[model samples]
Target: MAEETRTASRARAVALIADVVRWAGIIAAVILVIHVILVAGEANPANGIARTIHNLADALSLGFKDLFNKPADDPKLRTLINYGLAALFWLVVSSVAARLIRRLA
Candidate 1:
């Protein structure tokens, strides 16, 4: 029936959206973690790949980008805390959002 068809279509759409949201969040977390590794490993800042990843991580930081001011003696620590929180936020928020979307739809 048309009603059944519409319901199935709607379900498919919702599923797709949920998948996208989940993947995006996971990707963001991966980027953040990678940035942390690069920084911790003392990768060259002028390198293209490092810069690109740093920019992407910053973009995804969602205001947590500057959550902690760079301390005089421990700048890396600030990066770790801020980026770590952002990554965690994305993971938790995306999971909850995907679940809610699936449930509501």
Candidate 2:
């Protein structure tokens, strides 16, 4: 029936949206983790890997980059707070998106 086909199509769309959101969250979390590690480890900025991760994290955390500016003397603390905020931001946004998609579906 047309009704059943429409329902199936909606379900597929919802699943696709959910999957995209889930993957985005996961990738964001991974980037955050890498950023945290590089910062905590005092990775050399001149190194390619460290630079790449730092750049990726910076891009991903565009809005939250300055959410918490720790003292200059305490780089470790600053990294922790900033990266944690970024991770939280991604998780919350993705969760809300998935919920909205489900509701709409």
Candidate 3:
């Protein structure tokens, strides 16, 4: 009876973790979509952060001129690439985490 109780408790914990992970993934996706919309506006406060990131990229490109060729590589281009990569990373990570949690549950 004690062993059965332990197994049930473990199962309940897994379910709880899975639910949390699922919610987190949903929230992150929603946030990313909102951010994209705000960025598209180009006049929102969110744009300030985006601008700063762009400027930093520009500075890095300048410092590492040899790293990125002209025309093919620019601050805006780098920012887009970086952001795309980051979004992909988060999406995959969150999704995998959620899947694993769900399986455990």
Candidate 4:
């Protein structure tokens, strides 16, 4: 029936959206981890890979970037907190969005 077909299509659409959201969250988390590692290890910014990771992490962090300012005396702790928060933000947002999409679908 047309109704059944429409329902199936909707379900497929929702599944697709959920996959996208999950992948995006995973990517953001990975970036956050890489950024954390680079900072924690005191990676040389002049290096190509380090610079790339830093730039990508900065781009992904967007609104979450300045949530915590790193103290000059204890930069490691600050990096951990700020990047951890950014990763958490992406995880939560992506999860809630996927749940909502599935519910609506």
Best by lDDT: 1
**lDDT tens readout by residue for model 2, 1-105:** 999999999899898988799779879978988889888889999999999988999888867777777677888788878887898889888988888888877
| TM-score list, all predictions | 0.91, 0.89, 0.51, 0.88
| lDDT tens per residue, model 3, 17-71 | 8778766655554444444444445534556665564444333333332333434
Q: Estimate the TM-score for candidate 1.
A: 0.91
Candidate 4, 63-101: lDDT as tens digits: 777777758578877877888788888888898888888
How high a TM-score does candidate 3 get?
0.51
Q: Predict model 3's lDDT versus the native.
A: 0.54
- Each model's total of backbone clashes: 0, 0, 0, 0
Candidate 1 stretches greater than 4 Å from native: none
User: Following a full C-alpha superposition, what root-mean-square deviation does model 3 have from the true structure?
Assistant: 6.9
Off by over 4 Å in 3: 46-85, 102-105
Q: Per-residue lDDT for 99 in model 1? A: 99
Where does model 2 exceed 4 Å of error?
none
* Per-residue lDDT value at 31 in model 4: 93
* Candidates 2 and 3, the one with greater lDDT: 2
The alpha-carbon root-mean-square deviation between model 4 and the true structure, to one decimal in Å, is: 1.5
Task: Give candidate 4 misplaced runs (Cα > 4 Å).
Answer: none
